[model samples]
Target: MYYIGIDLGTSAVKLLLMREDGKIENVVSREYELSFPHPGYSEQNPEDWYRQTLDGLKALVSVVDPKEIGGISFGGQMHGLVALDEEDRVLRPAILWNDGRSIEEVRYLNEEVGKKVISGYTGNIAFAGFTAPKILWMKNNEPELFARIRKIMLPKDYLAYRLSGSFCTDYSDASGMLLLDVKNKCWSAEMLKLCGITEDMLPKLYESYETVGYLKPEIADSLSMRHDVVIAAGAGDNAAAAVGTGTVGRNKCNISLGTSGTIFITADSFCVDSNNALHAFAHADGHFHLMGCMLSAASCNKWWMDNILKTDRYAKEQTGIVRLGENHVYFLPYLMGERSPWNDPMARGAFIGMSLSTSRADMTQAVLEGVAFATRDMYEAAGSAGITPERTMICGGGARSPLWRKMISNILNISIDIPACEEGPGIGGAMLAMVADGKYSTVEEAAAAIVAVKSTCEPEPELVKKYEERYQSFRKLYPALKTVYGEL
Candidate 1:
């Protein structure tokens, strides 16, 4: 039997077909538009997601017999507000996870409502990207549209509903919505009351690997698949990627270096940081995990190479940096402001310690080092919670760069395990489907059977020493500039 994993990303929908034995058969990606209606606002049309996903699914299974496909699941961008009307029609373009238009709502939730109360209710404080804030933004700015909303769904849950004709979401995804009582694995009534929404307006929640429903008849017919193909309630992108990397169970960690960077630490029980610096969410493996996210990661490298240097030869540019931890130049990877430990949207990217003698390589190296240092910021926060990850599994586009991996390993002074397959969320979605189909008894079992480590990057003692000194200085830069950031 085969399984399909649909990764509904911000820019595209990537479909992956895998055999029951953990072999990838085929992969297809379809791109879509991401709109910016105003500065700091990001939105996407839900219709484009479904249309592209259907097309990608057809392409993914073109060479295989559709009857062999046993199940389908999703790993998608989390926290986007997708509203539906009484007739099940899309009420408006989704307010995306990267959208920062809810400053006022976020402030209200954090200050007026109080972080302690919000954290007590949802295990997290308010961020501009969270779904609850977006809902508040809708109510305050778009009153008519808010009034028409009969249903509120996350980005990938919308896709799941379209395929299975079931309105459902998994706990791993729902945890990011700021409406879930993550410790209890249910929606918080207090949060619902705060948002002026009812439980009926929300979708039914399920565990990540639980089967939501079978494919709708029309959906099955259009895709030439079995009507009985099960649809599993999949997870948020990070949690799904964690499953893909076998970062399940307690004390395991995974570092993702995609457009956004994250330090995911899985724990056997619920735990929240004293400062609420990390997000406490339910894991796909039926446990809890704390996550610290950085808004910009590999995207910073992309911007420097493509937008600044005007070069497509990324590898060649990285090759020019000879110094490992000696560069004096430092970069703040807050191009899109920041999240995680510092929830400040006014934070701006900066290049300090530059002089006329500074070369292009020096600046480029700073960007990479800056991202690593920022990752350490999250890592230290995890340490504060008594969760110390001695080693971490690495994935994402940035992980493809050997130099960056080395920098991350040394700067954080932790070993890095490179997965044999770095498919991230797409393969993870398939693994969830595998579990739902009983190919494996649990997510942990499926991950243990499927995930393989190809290589490990160990921190060099001397390099670690150098990075330790540099990190101390890197830590000071943020605080010294905090006031300047606020003024800007």
Candidate 2:
């Protein structure tokens, strides 16, 4: 039997067909437009997502025997506000997870409503990206639209609804909405009241591997598949990516350096930091995890290489960077503001300690090292809370760079393991479908059986010592600039 994993990303819907044995048979990506009507707002058409996903599925399964395709599932960008009217039509463009337009609403939830209260209810404080704040923003700014909402869904849940004819979301994805009582693994009435919503507006929540329903007959027929194709309620992108990299079980970690960056640490039991710095969300493996997200990671390097330097030769540009931790140049990786420890949307990217002697190589090296240092900040935060992971699986586009991986390994003083395949959430979503179809018993079992590590990068003691000094200085820059960032 075959299974399809749909990754509903910010830019596209990536569909992957995998055999029951975990071999990928086909993969297709369909791009869509992302709209930004305001300075910090990000929106997308939910209809575009469904249409592209349908087209991608048809292309993905064209070569396969339809009878052999058993199930479909999704791993997607989480916390996007997808509101529907009484007849289930999209009410407005979806406010995406990266959208920072909810700063005022976030402040209301985190400050006026009190961070302690939110932490007590959701195990997290407010962030501009969270769905609840976005809900508040909509209610206050666009009362007419808010009044018309009959259903509220996350990004991937909308895809699941279209495919399975069921309004549903998984625990891992719902955990980010600031509406779930994460510790209790259910919706929080207090949060719902705060957002001027009811529990009925939310989708039914399931575990990541649990089947939501069979595919809608019409949808299945269009793709030449069975109507009874099981649709598993998959996880948030980070949780799914963690499953893909075998970052389940206690103390396992994964670092993603894609358009955005994240440090995911899985735990068997639930835990939250005192400052609510790291996100306390449900893991796809039916447990818990702490995540620290930085809004920009590999995108910084992409901007530097593509937009700033006007070159496509990333490898060649990086080749000239020799010194790992000895460079005096420092960069703050806040191109898209920041999340995690700072939670400051006003923060901006910066380059400090640059002298006349600094060359192009030094600046390039700072970009890589800067991201590494930011990751180390998350690592230190996790350590502060008694969750110490000695090794981590690195994923996303930035992990492909050998030099960057080496720098990360040395700077963080941990083993950086590269996965056999770095497709992240897309692959994990397919694996979840396989598990739902009875190919595997548990997420852990499936991951342990199929997740393979291709290479391991370990830290050098000398470089680690050098980075230790640099990190101390790097940490100070943010504090000194905090007041200045607000003014800017």
Candidate 3:
């Protein structure tokens, strides 16, 4: 039998078809528009996500017998607030995870409500992009819409609801919502009160691989699939990607350098970072994990290549960067206002330490190294909690660059592995569906059986030493400019 994994991403929806044995039969993706109504606000229509996913699903299953489809699940962008009215109509465009429109609300949660109190309830502090802050933004800015919210969900859960009529979410996705008591696996009463909402407004929580319901007859028929297809509650993108890379079990790690960057490390037991720098959340493997998410990663490179250089030849831009750790130029990858560590929405990107001799190659090298250095900040935060992993599975657009991967390996002084299956979250979503269909007893067993590493990048000692000295200088730039950002 075959299972389908639907990846509802920021820019598009990708649907993958795979057998129970982990052989991918077909993959299809359909693009959608992302709206930016204000300078810092990011929004998307829920209808666009559903319509494109339906198109992608038909394309994915066209080569196979639809009756062979066993189940369907998802891996999606996390923490986007998708609100539904009493009649199940979308209230507004979903406020996405990277949106920074809730700056004031975030400040209220961290400063007024207090970080110690919020962290105790949800195992995390408020970020400008998190759902809890968005919830407050709605309450303060649009009380009429806030009053009509009958159901609140993450991005993929909205898809699950549209397909299965379950109105459910998985723990891994809900963890970023700031409404879940992550350590205990339930809704946080204090947070609900803070957001002026009731528990009934939230969806029922499930483990990532648990079955929500059978797909609705009409939805299944529309895609030429079985009406009895199991609908499994899936995970947030990072956790699902971690599962795809086999970064489950105790002390496993994965680094993603996509539109956003994250360092995910799984744990059998719950652990919190004292500074609340890293998110302590539930994992898809029925365990827990620590994560550090930075707002801009590979997008920094995209901005540099597309906007500044006016060329799409990303590899060509890197080919000239010969001086790796020896470059005196530096860049700050906070174009979207950093999340992990600093948690400052006012922070802005900058280029420093440029000399008359600084060439285009030097600036390009700085942009790539800047991302690695910011990620290393999160890596060390994990170290503070005694959760250091010797190696990590690498994924997303940035992982394809050998120069970037080598920089990461030496800068963080850890090995990086490329997964044989480059599908990432989509493959992990299929693995969850496979579990729901009884192909495997657990997510861990499915991951261990399906995930494979293709190659590894090891850190060079001399290069590591040079990057370490550079990183120290890199860390200082943010602090010096932080006041300047606020003044701007």
Off by over 4 Å in 2: none
Q: Which segments of candidate 1 are over 4 A away from where they belong?
A: none
| Tens-digit per-residue lDDT, 1-488, candidate 3 | 99999989999998999999999999999999999999889999999999999888888889999999999999999999999899999999999999999999999999999999999999999998899999999999999999999999899998999899998999999999999999999999999999999999999999999999998999888888888999999999999999889999999999999999999999998899769899999999999999999999999999999999999999999999877789898899999899998998888889998999989999899999999999999999999999889999999889999999999999999999999988889999999999988999999899889998899999999999999999999989999999999998
Which prediction has more favorable lDDT, 1 or 2?
Answer: 1
lDDT of 2 at 256: 95
Q: Is candidate 2 or candidate 3 better by lDDT?
A: 3
Measured against the true structure, the TM-scores of the candidates, in listed sequence, are 0.99, 0.99, 0.99
Instruction: Report lDDT per candidate.
Output: 0.94, 0.91, 0.93
Residue-level lDDT of model 2, residues 1-488, one tens digit each, is: 99888888888888888887778899999999999898778899999999999889889999889878998988899889999999999999999988998999999988899999999999999998889999999999999999999999998999999888888999999999999999999999999999999899999989999999999998878777888899999999999999889998888999999888999998888899767889999999999999999988998999999998999999999999888889999999998789978998888899999988999999999999999999999888898889888899999989999999999999899999999988889889988988888889999998988899999999999999999999999999999999999898
Q: After superposition, how far is residue 451 of candidate 2 from its true place, in Å?
A: 0.7
Error of 1 at 221 (Å): 1.3
